[model samples]
Target chain A: MEHLDYSNQAAWTRVSGDKQSPVALSDSLAVKNDFETTLSFNYDHTASYVRDTGAGIEVGLHGTANIGNRPFSLNQFHIHTPSEHTVNDKSYEAEIHFVHEASDGRLAVVAVLVQSGAASQTYDAVLAHMNQKETFDIPVDDIMPENKAYYHYIGSLTTPPLTENVEWYVLKQPVTLSTEQINHLKTFYSHNNRDLQALNDRPIISSN
Target chain B: MEHLDYSNQAAWTRVSGDKQSPVALSDSLAVKNDFETTLSFNYDHTASYVRDTGAGIEVGLHGTANIGNRPFSLNQFHIHTPSEHTVNDKSYEAEIHFVHEASDGRLAVVAVLVQSGAASQTYDAVLAHMNQKETFDIPVDDIMPENKAYYHYIGSLTTPPLTENVEWYVLKQPVTLSTEQINHLKTFYSHNNRDLQALNDRPIISSN
Candidate 1:
């Protein structure tokens, strides 16, 4: 197999191959890696959670070609207090993660920047439900737009063990939420952000 | 705080709270027990990949919500030949996984089912690219759609330590792919699937 060239955007097509081992035992013992992917939520795509707090994708939205052509069904979404990647040592107030995977084991993620701004139409639906202070659930399909543009790259596990080889798709444009929405997130996660670590030997590729 | 109630569906909103944790190491671990809510794509989302031969999600294109969320942006997805899940006494042909994480310290995943079928759109895209084969590399902002409807639960790492407390979101519905697509996947990984282990008394919650 050829070594992957992180600088080449087109190289992703060639590098997309399976690892001999699906799970690494050694990586598991390294407790320093505190995060694990192991949760599921089933709901209508149009529903929203009152406790939604500006984090998490609204449950029940659906998308095509979003999951390697397998058609990924949307679940719920959440936010990371403080941003994960620091642009020049500066992190944002928070980062939004849109996690998805295909039935054939093809994974994809859409990262959106969450900045303080006026209420965005995209976010108003969710914010409205949040303000209700009552039992509220809305379908994501009802609120989400149909834009499918994004950024992509190959990187490591940002957490511990920092596993390398995972694929990444970061959005160049950010989805909007309001200042009040951001503050609401802060209330729940006053300082939920994690500090930015060194890039190490990770390679970041920009599709644009 | 009130413990999350798994039995009632309508009561989800009243019961679910921000439940966001502070900067505690264990709190950070809270991410380990949470579900993801966004859809992501490979840097080469447009480029296609072979879908491994098998009975389920790995056959063509699939989606995973079982991806870990936090510390790193959720990246591209792939599958393993054979299968990681076990049945009454047998395993399937293969399994698919959606990998995800952030920079600070969070990880999550979402998995789906791939049964036998005809050729899939994903299969076509991946095959065309593989035919023009080259090295591997990840792209930024590949192809991302705003879909967030999914099923959320809690389970152990499909891999080792077989760590527990992993927040899982397995979608109830699954997309289909073709036999040709499945065969194409066999090209790169014929036996990447893992054997299913014990459930370890883990409770699967339908976070609808």
Candidate 2:
């Protein structure tokens, strides 16, 4: 635990196949998908009764979403300090991983790029419990931005075990957090984002 | 609870949307997706310890599978008598719902058609506890057949509140159970299957 071996990702000792995640995202390079794919999220409004996973994904969160014909249930989501997927080759302050799963055991991680800006009460409520280490549900419905446009691509889980073929749906629009909210997540795990992976000739489909 | 209200589905009163599940499946009508899609399952072997939901879907079983890039974790699975999704417009003897959920709270159900033939010892252990109402995990890895070919579609949950936009990956291959095994499951919920829903111009993707 002392030495976070993210260096393996840079050296390819742990690439786990070429389809790695946290790739550099560019709109110009992204192929516009022919079909209109609007992600519909029926996220639970009240995290009123969810067990706080701290920074894990094993809670029985009951939120759900649909992208095209794919159905994903919210397992649990956590923060990746400093954005993972870069937009226009630029990284943001932080990124939030709203990890979802389909019934077939496939993962569709909705990466919402987070930036420090106008005070967001929605984020404030979620962030308040970030450091508490208590049982709390992150009100995911409020975490989502109104814009649903996202970049779709086949990739791997950014974290350990680095499972490949995980769907990366990086929302085109970024969400805001107050400076306090941003630092609250950052203090837990600063510089926690993984090194960006190469696109590897993969087509990043833009949901226009 | 005395009278099952599946009649609502037959009368369209409970149709959450134009698209609902348990549709009559036909290969010729299924659109062959241009892309090759193979489902990969890395299921847990031991039912060693898992809480059985007693034909419900609120257990935290940790088997996972990948259909393309979508990742779903096995929440829990239950059986439906006389099958649900009919193949070639013919209903099978029984069906197993291996319900998996993605991180975003969407469901991708992999329906395995069942036929009574040879006794499957793999199933014998699972069936032993059907009526026991005990804490047991249905070994989903055992339930999936060797042949991965399936018919994929956009549908709603066959059960109540009937949420739509659920991805149904109905496996074309049918597995066998002994006459005794079939009877064991049947005794629990005889004729518990939902009525078939309209195809409604939904494209059932044949994953050949």
Candidate 3:
């Protein structure tokens, strides 16, 4: 019930560091409602990516994500390098995150794993906007992909202050890109990844 | 941008059957930019554990969660069984989801993996409410443990019509509960799980 800041040291410590406590699965947090409006991806909202001061490429992935019947608009895409999650003790170059939210206070995200690949239109859009002199939104309509199939699960934060109770939906298959795509990303965020943490004996469910 | 109901047969068929068509991560369809609260957790509010229609017993090990500088709140906990995700061909009993959101459309979640353990106070809170006959919040303030360490990553929906673009934080270590807790969960919802889908070559990262 208490509100917190993005940089609240104490609160952040509690959220990013509390791993010993048990957490209940809040059913109310699930996306059980229908969104009233429809939103589409804006391949043109190109903006510079910046997390913890590191700069990279970012594009908006628009969509309508509803919760409790209230619709939230999803926007923006970014990546973390070195993979924050480990599957059977394996990690990858980086992971992509799509952020979304509803009008009343509902959140939903669609995450995709980025591995070594060829040049991807999405990545290209991000790269075009990568520059120390620029930090603005761009148009991404030309490069946005059209695939929607995905895998869903509920997981925790991969970073420190390991909080629990987040829903996850990973795509079963990845969109294809060229090797150039991976290299382009690496150019901006060569090591933009968190290390692999322990599974903590948790099971990941595939929402097929 | 077009708004769509997830259950709409036409929408489902349109997006479900196609692989190449762009399932845009559209944000306009759903409501966006309404919630504006911090992302944090609270234990007091998570007293009433409802056997989610699908997820089994969800014990609120920690209190409500607070996101980074947002208005939405992380209310409670829940779980998915039989492994919705597979790291490298392995699975666990169940996964716990700690959901959170902010008022201005910011969302953050911390996920923890649970294994079989001896019955403890945390499990008792959940088991006590397992009957589904009662509908009230539980009192789990005393037994809640501290979770300050974890791994963080960004991911998406773990189910069908997988949405993209969200942040993720998974704890490296899994908290423990008694085998009774696991059994108690199973007694109520035996087959409430999703199968593990293909990895799709997605790279997982750890926020360690």
Candidate 4:
């Protein structure tokens, strides 16, 4: 299998362009607040979130999230330095994508933006064990934020063969990670994010 | 996430009842041998082939396989200490499930049985890297067999939520792994296979 270059002009590139990207979400879109997500940190140490780039320090967390009456299994979550999606053309320090799939094979992704601020215990815990080569367990709720407001849209995976029609929910709230933590992650994947992509006239919906 | 017990009698348990196992396959079944598969080691390390059992030492390989005119991406593959499916009441030492999914979220799986015989370099490579905590790349063709003859059927994932209507292709040929390799895998998951399920009158077709 060939490794995809995250910083190239690949068709599956996830970099969001300022124009045609997701706009400030509005409240007109249907909002479902009861999304239930459960996380288990029993991940494979050999799994890489991004191909090549030597960023193989990812843990597969087995989880399931219930959204809009549909049950999605949380397959994997990886961090992208400098983030993928932009808000009104503003990029964050990092982005965490919680990839979920329904039984029928439909995909729903929850994007959480990471910024430098107060130290987060969740981030600290993840960083602490990032170098472990063995599978372990962790509580899902401990790492998730209480805020559930999000910007919903339909987009494709930012990676190769970039499969489209993926249901995306970008949380309006940003998760806090200290400056030291952000820098530590960058050591693994610096500038390892895709360029902004065309929104193709997709509407960005927000939960009221 | 809490590790799922593979030996338990959960509703989604993969253990099949010996009395109602799949019978010998016939040649009348539709056997598509030319299904095209492309491999990419670009997978989310957070994804597990098995639902639980805390076997997080697995790797996620990304690539698409064309089956029945539909393109299914090779998301992840995992090993069961003992084979999950039985043929005419015969069970192998282990089973490898190559899980593939279509763009619309439909799943098609290819199951290859592993037994003790000559040393297999592919299995050795996978076992060699099983303890690594980082994601890396490997050739899909190296791990897959040249022969495509298989048994066709419709079943559910042996894991939780046990989604049904999944297209299954169990290769007729068994891959050989040294006794040392099989025992090494058992060290991680001795009785990790689920109990056999009742066939429910579903016909198993052979690609003869």
lDDT of 4 by residue, B76-172 (tens): 7877767877665578888888888754345678877888887766666566566455554454453466777677766666554344446677786
Residue-wise C-alpha lDDT for candidate 1, range A56-134, written one tens digit per residue: 3233334433332224444445566565554433456666655565432334555555566655554556556653444
Clashes of each: 122, 30, 170, 30
Cα lDDT tens digits for candidate 3, A1-109 = 1212312222322112222111221223223221122223433353545332333344544545542233447666667654544433445566666656443222355
Candidate 4 wrong stretches, greater than 4 Å = A1-57, A139-142, B1-208
Candidate 3 TM-score restricted to chain A: 0.58
Worst 10 residues of 4 chain A by lDDT: A13-22
lDDT of 3 by residue, B17-102 (tens): 11111111212222222333322445554454455443344543334454433233555566665434333344556666665653
| Candidate with more favorable, higher DockQ: 2 or 3 | 3
Q: Which candidate is the best by TM-score?
A: 2
Q: How would you order the candidates by TM-score, starting with the best? A: 2, 4, 3, 1
TM-score of chain B of each: 0.50, 0.82, 0.60, 0.72
Better of 2 and 3 by lDDT: 2
Deviating ranges (above 4 Å) for candidate 1: A1-45, A48-70, A88-90, A105-107, A131-149, A154-166, A197-200, B1-208
Best by lDDT: 2
Give each prediction's DockQ, rounded to 2 decimals.
0.03, 0.02, 0.03, 0.02
Let me know the DockQ for model 1: 0.03
* lDDT, model 1: 0.40
TM-scores of the candidates are 0.36, 0.48, 0.38, 0.41
